[model samples]
Target: MEYISFARLIEAVYLPQIIYTVIALTLSCMSSHRSSTSTELLTAATVQVSSDNQSPNSGNPENTYSDIISSSVHNITVIGVYMVIFAIAGNLMCSYFSGDACTIISTYLEIGGGVPVLYSMDISTKIKTALILSLTAFGGLSALFQSRDMIRISGLSFIKYTTGKIVCAFLCFIFYMMCL
Candidate 1:
């Protein structure tokens, strides 16, 4: 679905930047905590590289490749866990409100799945359009949870991120109404 495709595109473009930012922030925090200057940190990293070059297994390409692969796997596993948690929470919330297990399950198929589901209902067009746009803007609790998990490591305030999302959603709703 278009939603899944868009999600993948967004993830591909933003996830690496996010991971890099987290790493940089973490290193910055650690350096500050230890009273180590950036120069010292750079020197330490250089020393580490030189030491790695001198290690017994340094000549083995397979070892280095496997290390890279393992780290990649670890990152993938963390992402998978985030997805699972998000799915579970979405299901719970959807069930509580809709009281229909089938509809709750199907909405996970795409970002705008709810639009089609809402269309089949007997609701008025105005209410349906409002709900569709609202859902599209909110992007579900799963997205919120995933984003929170991603940025939590950088010691960033989750409240600000959440507020931004809500504000964006509200603005989108307002714009939609103004157009009508």
Candidate 2:
């Protein structure tokens, strides 16, 4: 899906933050907190609200919003902090080198760093584009670890995820070459 690519397109520093929010929301919605039991609890809560002359879900907007926010805050904060650290570290590492070495190191460190480096390098545009595409498709090592950490309990294997990235990166590389 396009969103999956968006997830790996770490070029946008805020992409991971948004992705983490969506992921947390999705996981929370799929969680026991959102089960039929929650509906039943809501029904009981609604009855209590009705007795007090209030609507079901509409009466206590603050309560619902606060609950959602509180439940998702911890995970989102942790992931956001991690990403900030990632970006800072990548920038710091890139500061040590210039030219192609910087490009190579940054690309290896994070896909986000690769795009600018790819553009700044003295290489042919076609090669730069292909490499950038490959970096986005492969998502570098940081994304792999981030995704693995996020989905560790989802029954998806890291090997499969990495294989998928490789396949996608290879396909993108081929496509870029053909188009050029």
Candidate 3:
């Protein structure tokens, strides 16, 4: 009886897992190309904002900042870098205007990611899996390329991060197989 119930539970979740796995693999492959473009975008933002010594007269501040944030492209290679950089820029700008950086960043992530929002539960788990893979792959490739500081993830070293990614990817495939 116990074994039969466990089998049924697995069967119920299997198809979604397989779909998630395929999506995760595809996202990982896309992330490789995004890493390079992301690096470039990060570099541009750092140059424009990080230097306190730059003269305010060099260009209109709005243009300088807007250039960093306005990207509508959705290709993983382009949109990945664009959204990350734009989010940082948005947070940085909010801090500059509101005088509270940490609060702004936290709020932005919460609102943008629906992190604490219950509605996020309905979001596709496959997307969550894809995001994890993309982020892990991007961070690993960035470190290998010597831009470790550009993408800072807390609490996990690169090896651990990559290991977790692999485990998740495997589970995603297993989930699919179980469903099939």
Please name the candidate that would achieve the greatest lDDT relative to the true structure. Answer: 2
What tens digits encode model 3's per-residue C-alpha lDDT throughout 3-52? Answer: 23555444434544455569765875689786666577667666655573
Best TM-score among the predictions, by candidate number: 2
Worst 10 residues of 2 by lDDT: 1-10
CA error at residue 19 for candidate 2, angstroms: 25
Clash counts per candidate, in order, are 0, 0, 4
Candidate 3 displacement at residue 130 in angstroms: 15
Runs of candidate 1 exceeding 4 Å displacement: 1-68, 94-120
Which residue pairs show collisions in model 2?
none
Query: What number of backbone clashes does candidate 2 have, counting pairs of residues 3 or more apart or in separate chains?
Result: 0
Assess candidate 3 and give its lDDT: 0.43
Q: Which stretches of candidate 3 lie over 4 Å from their true place?
A: 1-63, 66-150, 153-156
**Which candidate do you rate higher for lDDT, 2 or 3?**
2
Q: What clash pairs does model 1 have?
A: none
lDDT of 2: 0.63
- For model 1, give the 10-residue run with minimal summed lDDT: 1-10
Tell me the TM-score of model 1: 0.47
Candidate 1: C-alpha RMSD to true structure equals: 9.7
* lDDT at 126, model 2: 63
